[model samples]
Target: MMLPKAAKDPSCGAPKHTGLLREELLVFRHLLGLGENPSQIRLGPPLSNSSLKDILFVSIDVDGPRDFKCAENSPCLVGISILDTRRLQFYMTTISVAAKTRSALGNVENLIKSHQLQVGQSNHLSYRSSKFLFGETRQIKADKVKTYLQRLIKDRFFVLVTYGGGAADCIYLEGLRLGIRPLYHLDVLKVAQFPLQTYYRYSLAKILDALKLPWQDLHIAGNDARFTLHALLMTAVRDWNYRDDKPKSKPTPSTQVTLSSIKTIAKAWRIPDQDQPSLSFLFEDHIIKERVLLNPETRKNGKRLRPEKTPEEKAQRRERKKLAKEKRKLKEARRPQWLFNLGDLLDNE
Candidate 1:
């Protein structure tokens, strides 16, 4: 299956000779042993006849608690980096939706604030300010996270790309029951190894540096997703033959398109420039916090509301109180006159 070489990739303005090939992509997939793991990869979706441009590359990175066990139990920040190869454009959405409870406020606030603090300290991708900086940080309900993802991948065949083989992202998305699945699964971490020739699982930041692709603020789900997709594209363009040569600093066509698209989308959002602290409130789940605070009796810790006592239980409580009162009266009646006099003397003193 010899695929044609791209003459000119308008996305990055890269030379035709260095452009990506579909055959190269297939070879890359095979080299990574992607087809061997049916449990992790789905190869039966008839991608053989499809050109690389025909498939959507969806890169997902989810941010949850450090102890993130599963998406169901934890609140997730979803970062979706989408490359529509046909259009030669990129679309990204980094969602920071907190659970509809007051309990999520502290953690969500800290994540956004920490990222805000590190915005301009370094040129490294790890310090890349999020697209949210240019756009209004809109809040959405936690339940809507799945629907938002579904809307993006609907009516499209996408290849799911992620760092660390996306085991957690798969569980998170599947747990949401997205229904739509990727045509193929590509791991940027594994894809990177073929070029770097190491079994060690390097961090996405390190892999991006190794591939000579620019990375932005990492750990933020959206930025991570964007990085993952670009990393996969850059890895695809690499020659499988081992080379001691260091990767060039030039950005790929896919990366160029991604950055441009981000700016375009940010411009469309028309968010006014302000201090980071001022914008931080938008990312916080204030609506949920406000709702939770309205009830005076409600615990701020997000515990379940106490149910009203049943008639039988109330009657039992009353009975217990009566018995306690009677017992107290009996004890008082049994008290010695000397003790009563002593208590009177102490009170007078």
Candidate 2:
């Protein structure tokens, strides 16, 4: 199918096809089997501190970058997920693109082929997981992705929770600008990384590991989205539970947030929000709290807490100061003791 073509948007890069994941559909069917209504429901606010039932997590994963000005990029695969904020594995609904053939799906065969050495040239994994992993590619693909995403975008779901409102946020907003109406604006969250980077750093595999879910046919957008959702949920849970259960008038959670993505650490990055309308909630307070133990800084209440120093550190400082003072006193007493005694005795006399 001829890929949908749009103007080149420097901000968004080139568009890519969103993969249609059939596994998600099967899961959706399983969800239906449970007799839960599949109707689109507006998500409630994502409670960073609330229980899993109180919060809902939604996320979108686009495989390729697109231009903000135009949709000239080939639409590859975009994966989306709705899940419990507390339990990432409990997926409410996962919607992804499905094509008629695996080849038609942008993120499926092509990705595995690119990693021939890693995944195998004969496509053992790809062949084995073909039927179970991806949905058949669509025969007649749409030219523009805006129309497709318009149907997928839900109200009240937070955006840019993955990349910290970086380029992903830009592409989403640009899609909103040119796509159909019902552009629901919600708060954007910027979660910090964990103190121990390796322990807290998450991926689709890591998320699956945490959930104890089987990790197979991974890397597809839909799978990625699900994993990303769970990963974020795990991070949020860690952040929430790290603090005391008791409600304090003054709370600090940033000390617990330690999530870091490629863009979040960029030294020079100012995200663009051209047509991003106010979704009623300005997220100035939505920033994740991070515990900065080493550097003493002004707190929200204007009181500056001293840098958190360990007992050993304080003791070392005290020892150093005491030794320096003793050294100076000894130097003074060395040669000056006689002269100092002479002056004192003369004055007394």
The most accurate candidate by lDDT is 1
Residue pairs clashing in model 1 are 12-253, 125-215, 125-216
Task: Predict model 1's lDDT versus the native.
Answer: 0.51
Per-residue lDDT tens digits for candidate 2, residues 1-349, read 1111221333545334221212222222122121122345432333444322233334555444455346434344555554433332121112121212222222222211010101112243334324223244221243444544444443333333343333663565455464333212221122323211222234556544543434455655555554454444344333333322324553333222222110111111112234442221223344444544453345645456667899999999999999999999888867755786798889899
Show model 1 residue runs off by greater than 4 Å: 1-50, 66-73, 89-137, 240-349
Q: Please give the lDDT score at residue 323 for candidate 2.
A: 100
TM-score of model 1 relative to the true fold? 0.45
Off by over 4 Å in 2: 1-56, 65-75, 84-144, 154-160, 163-169, 172-192, 195-214, 244-349
**Every candidate's lDDT:** 0.51, 0.36
Cα displacement (Å) at residue 166, model 2: 5.7
Candidate 1 minimal-lDDT segment of 10 residues: 111-120
